[model samples]
Target: MLFNIFISDLDIGIKCTLMKFADDTKLSEAVDTTEGRATLQEDLDSLEEWANKNLLKFNKTSSSSVERDLEVLVDNKLHVSEQCTAVARKANRMLGCIKDTTSRAKVITPLYSVLVRPHLESCV
Candidate 1:
């Protein structure tokens, strides 16, 4: 018999869904506590077992790349990727706006709408 693995958050009483696109699989959950972390770890272990049983293996390099990103987020407290920062700096400079200088309302509004709005909106 074949079955898909499902993860549940016992504390919040919600089930975590796994998303897959082609060969890419994503597992996400709101992990803010010890129990949540343990639950996620358990789910990962189960996934590894299931993959091995089905003759499927995760890409090691991709897994490590994701781990590095997670480490950066945890250590920095901000999900500021290289591309995002570059775009933000470019946006600020495009309209002759300094980082800390107070600019006129008209200039600031358009600068934000054109350059910064897309990056902020993309996160959501």
Candidate 2:
């Protein structure tokens, strides 16, 4: 049981993620389900023996991720996602600038019309 606790903790990283030990009583029960705490200690001792024999084999493979083996395939996908977000933000800003430019042009058009109106009146 103690070995299972150690294995679960090592494999899962966070004790909060262990569903089997959701509460204090569950954790206590898992640590020493047998006769006594000494039995749990003895189980840990045997686990050490087994690990020493086969631990090198386990360390050869990654304990973290499988994506590293497929890095080339995954890189373009991640790049595309980042590029899309950058382009979307740039497009949003571009549209805002275009709208503001159009609005200012509209305001200037009426002023231009007013100045031309008097000049045309005098020429006519």
Candidate 3:
């Protein structure tokens, strides 16, 4: 609540869509044309100015080719295969780690339920 109050004016001068969740802020606009790209850039500049004025710093390492909205990976075509594959890969990694750490017969069920199930359930 205090953080929200401090940053409530973040969208005051932004023209594009501004999504704020916890500490993450995203500027979204369709960049199908030169004008749209220019507008998005202008909004980005404004955001930077705002951050500077407010003494805030943004995470520089959080960018990704696949955009995530509300914790779901999304692409232009809105296909689920990428999300499914990512989840499966993560779950497999966790399973491998669990296999190395303990005997499967002893802790597989509990470990899978605690660590791996959420990744499998993330898609669809």
Best by lDDT: 3
Model 2, residue pairs in steric clash: none
TM-score of 3: 0.60
Scored by lDDT, model 1 comes in at 0.55
Candidate 3: residue 68 lDDT (0-100)? 67
Q: Rank the candidates by lDDT, best first.
A: 3, 1, 2
Stretches of candidate 2 off by over 4 Å are 1-79, 103-124
> Candidates 2 and 3: which is better by TM-score?
3
Best by TM-score: 3
lDDT of 1 by residue, 17-117 (tens): 56654435677776899878887777777777766766777775532222233223222344546545555665557545533555678767776787667
After superposing candidate 3 on the true structure, give the runs of residues whose Cα lies further than 4 Å from its correct spot: 64-68, 74-80, 86-124
lDDT of 3 by residue, 4-49 (tens): 9999999998889999988678799999999999999999999989
How high a TM-score does candidate 2 get? Answer: 0.22
Per-residue alpha-carbon lDDT of model 2 for 6-104, expressed as tens digits?
455332222222234332111121444445565545544454454575462224343432222222212323333433444455555655555666667
Worst 10 residues of 3 by lDDT: 62-71
